[model samples]
Target: MRSCKDYSAKIPNVKPALCEAAQLQDSKARSVLGRPIWSRDVQAQGAPLRVLVLGGIHGDEMSSSSLVFHWIALAQTPPSDTPVPISWRFIPTLNPDGMFAKPARRVNARGVDLNRNFPTPNWARDARHYWEERTRRDPRRWPGTQPLSEPESRFLLEQIDNFKPNLIVSVHAPYGVLDFDGPSVPPSRLGRLYLDQVGIFPGSLGNYGGIHKGVPVVTIELPSASRTPQEAEMRQMWMDLLRWTTERLGSSASTTPASPDLPKSP
Candidate 1:
């Protein structure tokens, strides 16, 4: 993984202080090129709710990773007024290899789109068909040889199984819209982006986690791939999320009952 200093040069709007403050831990997972994928767990007083926020699944989305770093800084100081205490796990730069590539491509070193490599239902049939037909075999959107074929995607699956987050927030960019999948009522808006229920893809995290796994997955597509929204905007989005989470998932009286198909996605 790159040092904080390196991040300053690579990612737009990211200062070295932001990376250092995130205090990311080694996830013990690596990309195809052996770059460490880091994770950080932030707490808000008690074990009330759990949220998993992921960014940089696509390397070219520099702003996505930057936003995660900024959120980490914000998460460090939990608001005293908030009622729900959250156990937040953040995976910043899930595709470090792609982020650090010569020109920062969207796929991994093996040229697989990790976003399209989740083990969703009927991945072999649907993923391939989507790639060949729907996407017209777009190389950047390749679903890989099979679902969970790459180490990155497998690590994410393990995180989902182990973390069992009540909600999953996956960040991406340049689309400027918010998407929701799973059991609860979705947030109408986060900052400037409003709820836009884009149809699910065959092997997307939103599809697998939100639809298949039954977890509420909030997908944020920022307005720019390289430029992060203003600091105030990002903070507003965070606060909005906190409010929605507290309303929608505050009652953690019942933890997910585990089974092959017991609890569900994103």
Candidate 2:
């Protein structure tokens, strides 16, 4: 359970950029709303093992955003001669309009759930009904009128295309489990916490990237959205994630066969 204080030298003071609408607001709201924070490191050789980590796609999941910010702060310092050569891109909050809403909405300013707005093959056919049945037509889970309809979702897709991440870790909250999609590899301590693999939805990043595009997408569901992790828990989770990443990408261990029965997008 190491603290960021222990690696203070490695942490950089990176700032955030405001989204288009946020920039139009008065100074206070502009600073807080519709802002996206990112940290990038591309100092590796050849085509570096690109990794993208995102948080706060569902804006109500505030803890996920906090965890990502914490990780970004700690990862700012360049790694020293690490076995894994990687280029990291961290996005702390993608749906800032929802996250900064007075009561923190699950959907963005347009009332669309960014998570269900990716342009997956089944988006047109399955997103709306699946959301309706799953949450009893909850507004919180409403898919957009069409895939990639919202700016937030489109922005995420743009990053995926530009960065071409080898692995993506999207953090969510209050689910207390780890759900993974794509190729199979040795399970890690993080996966052990939530071994029950959840089914993928039509336009979920898991379905679009992992299932369809053959990329690994690991969704880390935090224990609670209402509360940030205690120091010890935060450190433990960070260590486990780092270990999993290094083992999966840096070593030959990642060559383990893909699961023949991996869930397919509906």
Candidate 3:
């Protein structure tokens, strides 16, 4: 495993101060327009709880990306004096090309919905029909020609394999609910802001991480997709997330190794 100090030296465009000396890995995969996908891993001694936070799988959901950037900024100057016991990895804006485009598209430049492009077990059989029938052939939810066909989705899968986070928090928008998969994560005080729990979709990250890999996935559907949350709201969400991880999921003495039996595209 690469140390934080090693990452600082090897990875370009990552400031040591911003990440607090965390290990950074730039995915070899790129968006259709060639935007690099970046992930920062904050390591802890012994076996630490691993948490992966993702935002902006859908480029149109600006708030998701904004909140992630806000979290990264906050990480530069953490509020609490006590150190967090978890190993945190943040991936801000996986679909940068789409995000940067005019009017911000929901899919990547290739028109593939990165979120629905994961290589789930039933991807081949269900993805097309689900996108066609359930979503009514909505271009926004297109699952691509095949699973992991898009570079962005492939990059995310690689990150999942490398990071092996016990918990995955993917931020989405306009739904205003907290949808969970894998093991049960009971609603907390903060969960009142997002009281509803939605079902999983075919070839989604939730299905890939939670159902297939046995990793817990918390899908935070923000109230709005157009605008970022207020500073107070964002901070509150962050605090709540920290509380949820520590309180709900018991702390561990050692970190578990990355699962080698992850699904792969044939």
Candidate 4:
């Protein structure tokens, strides 16, 4: 039974983690909440494809939180080279206030669910006004007075604008569903691979992303807040995702022009 004030205290100050991930002397970027947010650059020489991995959108979704943290750990020593093929930008935890303060609180310091707070086209017309109709005893839905009202939501919006990733993955929990969304259809293999890994029904992040922007977004749902799956299950899902991404990248790379040194001779 955490009160709003109590929950506000739990939001982890992401500054420390963000700095560590970007390996920046100091984080120059800031989230909409005014917390420090950082970006690490892994540039590719040619038209490098960009991907954004956002986790912890829901405060209580521990598996998603763990996954993003794992990714940040990897980024600390990411392969260093120009034209690295893929540039990954991670927002390890979006709702720091919700995460640290109210591990139980799904919403922010203001009691707004960052996910539902997104600026959907019909936001105003949304009758439920999620906050007023919260489902949980210690629930997360409450869209604030308006959409994009909370800082965390705004922070994500900024990331979308600056990074413009070709793909976005938003992780959530308890349903074990892998939702694929975007303006265009997802690769058929993706749907099957996700089903094989997480073992839940498929879902769509692009339903909202599509209305706002045409980019594809996928939501990877985990089992639940309290029940963390076995490591083997988690590993299998990630491996599948990696395999899919790798195959896609390989196809893209093959279409590229011949190397500089050999091309001149021709």
> Largest TM-score belongs to which candidate?
1
**Residue 180, candidate 2: how far off, in angstroms?**
0.5
For residues 1-266, could you state the per-residue lDDT of candidate 1 as single tens digits? 36677777888888887888787787878888898888888854445678899999999999999999999898889788987777788998899899999999999999999999998989998999989998889999998999999999999999888877889999999999999999999999999999999989989999999999999999999999999999999999999999999888987524432222112110
Off by over 4 Å in 1: 252-266
**lDDT tens readout by residue for model 4, 79-161:** 44423355566665676556665335576677766777776666766623433443432354555667677776776776677
Ranking by lDDT: 1, 3, 2, 4
For candidate 1, the clash count comes to 10
TM-score winner between candidates 3 and 4: 3
* TM-score for each model: 0.94, 0.76, 0.81, 0.67
Give per-model CA RMSD: 4.2, 9.6, 6.8, 8.9
Query: In model 2, how large is the Cα lDDT of residue 152?
Result: 74
Instruction: Flag clash pairs in model 1.
Output: 209-265, 209-266, 210-265, 210-266, 213-264, 213-265, 214-264, 214-265, 215-264, 215-265
Question: How does model 2 fare in lDDT?
Answer: 0.66
Return the clash pairs for model 3, or none: 47-254, 47-255
Residue 52 error for model 4, in Å?
A: 0.4
Following a full C-alpha superposition, what root-mean-square deviation does model 1 have from the true structure? Answer: 4.2
- Model with the higher lDDT, candidate 2 or 3: 3
- Candidate 3 lDDT by residue in tens digits, 1-266: 33333323332233355445333466456788886676665544443567888988998887786667667665545555434466667887788777777768889999999889998897889999998889899998899999999888888887788777878889888778888888756544343466466778889999999999988898888888876667788778877877777666645424454432222211
* Segments in model 2 whose C-alpha atoms lie over 4 Å from true places: 1-47, 77-81, 251-266
**By TM-score: ranked, best first:** 1, 3, 2, 4
